[model samples]
Each structure stands twice: as structure tokens, then as C-alpha cells.
Target chain A: DVKVTQSSRYLVKRTGEKVFLECVQDMDHENMFWYRQDPGLGLRLIYFSYDVKMKEKGDIPEGYSVSREKKERFSLILESASTNQTSMYLCASSDRGPQETQYFGPGTRLLVL
Target chain B: QQQVKQSPQSLIVQKGGISIINCAYENTAFDYFPWYQQFPGKGPALLIAIRPDVSEKKEGRFTISFNKSAKQFSLHIMDSQPGDSATYFCAASYYGQNFVFGPGTRLSVLP
Candidate 1:
């Protein structure tokens, strides 16, 4: 079984503070992704990394960035957290293949106050 | 614009009844479709998936019905149970690319 783990299950930060969400996968998957899920909005991609040091912007990449220094770890960084940035952050990893099944972490519920 | 459209934002079904959720995609390049189930406070988990080549795929009580020409697909839950209640999201992707998820449907199975 693929295991994806996040650094935090819940976090609260003040406005204009820097925040970091970390994700690690044990499956040695080549593809990792960050997504923010909101009510009625579903899961919107924030950023994705195909390989080490390789990053791609998804549909909603504003106010956020990513780092993939290693294959097992992917981190999401908020330059300066704002109240609007509060959301449930999910990290997923998938193997490189024709039919990839993304395994997601439990998610970090961030609250930017 | 939403690439994938899902209908019935919410659904309530009684136990032993069937629960159906539908999704349609506009992208012709999409060949893989998957359904995810998300419980409260938990991340979405892959439930079942189907490809365009197959019209239907069943895993236990969960079934995926696909319509290639119409660019549509659906998930059918037989013998709905209270444990089946969750948010179901339909997604589309080209091969193994980044998946575009639907708006999602909140299902409630009344016991």
C-alpha cells in the first residue's frame, strides 16, 4: 500500500506569516501534487512535481509555490499567508505510468487568521 | 470554465436503494475516468475507475458505467448503506496526467 503522510493535520497562522506544508510518500512515485479543496469547488490543483527540481503550475498556483528537492518529499510554501489562503491542503503521489492512481494524504486543514 | 460537470450537488438515498451520480467531461483527450470518495475530515480515496474502451466495470457494489460517444460516465452504488455516505468526486484525465475533478456530489445514505 502506498502511504502519503503530511507534516501537520491542522495548522493556524496569522496573516502575512510564512507557512509550509510538507508531504512525504513511501512508494517512490515520480509524480507528486498539491491541491486545495473547498466546498463546492472540489479539488483544485495548486502545483505538481514530476521529478526532483521539476515543478509545474496547476490551475490555481497563485499565492503558492512548491519545492521538490527529493523524490519522497514535496513541500508547499505560502509566501505570506492570508485569510483567503485558509483551506484543506492535500498531497498526492502517483507512479509514472499510463494509468496512475494518485494516493492522497490525510490532508492538512490550515486556518489563516 | 469547468471541464468536468457533475450533477446533483447532493443526494439522499435509503438503505437497500441505489445511489447514482453522473459526470460529463468536455475534453475528448480524456481516456481515463476515476471516482473518489471523501469522508469528512479525510482525504479523497480512489474508489473505482474505468476506461473508454470498456462500457462498464464493477467492483463489489460499486459500478462505473461509461459512454464513450456521449463523453459521459456515472457511478452506481447498489444496496446503499450508511457507511457509503460521503462526497463522491468524478475526475477525468488524459492517460495519467493531472486529473480534473468535478464539483463533487455529497451523498447521504439514510439508515
Candidate 2:
């Protein structure tokens, strides 16, 4: 089974504070992704990492960044939390291929004040 | 811009009923289409997928129907039980790259 784990189930932060969300996958997939889910907007990809030290911006990458220093772990960083950035963050992993299947983590609900 | 559109923001079905959800994509370049199921308080999971080469694909109770000419696809759940109730999202991609996701459809199955 493919297991993806996020560091937090819930988080609360005030404006201007920096926040970090971590994710780990045991399957050793080559591709990792970060997405945020909002009502009516669905899920929007924030960033993607196909290999360590490499990253690509997704549709909604503004105000967010990602780091992949290891194969199994990916981290999403918020430079400064804002109310508009509050949403459920998700992490997903997939094997390296054109027919890859994404396995998602439970998600972290973040609240910004 | 690539986009996927889905209809019927919410649905209510009785037990042992069939649930159908529709999606349409704008980019004809999209080759892979997948449906994802998300439960409350949980992340989305891959339910079923279909490539443009096949008109239909089935796995047990879940099925995907594709129409290349119309740029559309759909998911049908047979004998939907309460456990099948969740938010479903349809996504399209080109060889699994540059995925574009639809809003979502929330399904409720009553006992």
C-alpha cells in the first residue's frame, strides 16, 4: 500500500507568521505535489517536485513555496500567513511515469487569523 | 487555459440507486482522465481512470464513460451505498502532465 503522511492535521497561525507543513511518503515515489482545497474552488496545485532540489510552480503557487531535500519528504512553506491563505493543504506522491497514480495524505486544515 | 467543468454541485440518492456525475474538459490535448473521491476530513483518493483510447472502463461498481468527440466523460456508480457518498472530482491531463481538476460534486446516499 502507498502511504502518504502529512505533519499536521490542523494548524492555527496569525497574520505575518511563517508556517511550515511537512509530508512524507513511504513508497519512494519520484513525484510529489502540494495542493490546497477550498469550497467551490476544489483543489489547486501549488507546487510539484519531480526530484530532490527541483521544483515547478503550479496554477496557484503565489505566496507559497516547496522544498524537497530528500526523496521521501516534501515541505510546504508559507512565507507569511494571511487570512486568504487559510485552506486545507494536501500532499500527494506518484511514481515516475506518464501513467502514474497519485496517493494523497490525510490533509492539514490551516486557519489564519 | 486548461479547465474541467462538472455539474450538479450536490446530489442525493437513496440506497441501491445509481449515481452519475458528468465532466467536460476544454483542452483536447488531454489524454488521461481520472476521478477522485474525497471523504469529509480526508484527502482525495483515486477512484477510477480512463484514457481517451477507451470509451469505457469499469472496476467493480465504478465506471467511467468517455466521449472523445464531445470532450466529455462521466462516472457512474452502480447500486450506490452510503459508503459511496463523498465529494467526487474529475481531472484531465496530457499524459498525466499539467493536470486540470474540476470543482467537485458532493453525493449523499440515504439509507
TM-scores, all candidates, are 0.96, 0.93
Write model 2 residue lDDT over A1-113, tens digit each, in one string: 99999999999999999999999999988889999998888888999998899999998999998899999999999999999999999999887756556788999999999
Off by over 4 Å in 1: none
Ten residues in sequence with the least summed lDDT for candidate 1 chain B: B91-100
lDDT tens per residue, model 1, A2-68: 8999999999999999999999999999999999998867898999998999999998999999999
Per-model lDDT: 0.92, 0.91
Candidate 2 residues B1-111, lDDT tens each?
Answer: 588999878999999999999999988877689899999989999999998889999999999999999999999999999999999999886644467788999999999
The residue pairs found clashing in candidate 1 are none
- Scored by Cα lDDT, where does model 2 land? 0.91
Query: Which candidate gets the maximum lDDT versus the true structure?
Result: 1
Residue B97: error of model 1 in Å?
2.1
Q: Report fnat for all candidates as fractions from 0 to 1.
A: 0.46, 0.45
How much does candidate 1 score in TM-score?
A: 0.96
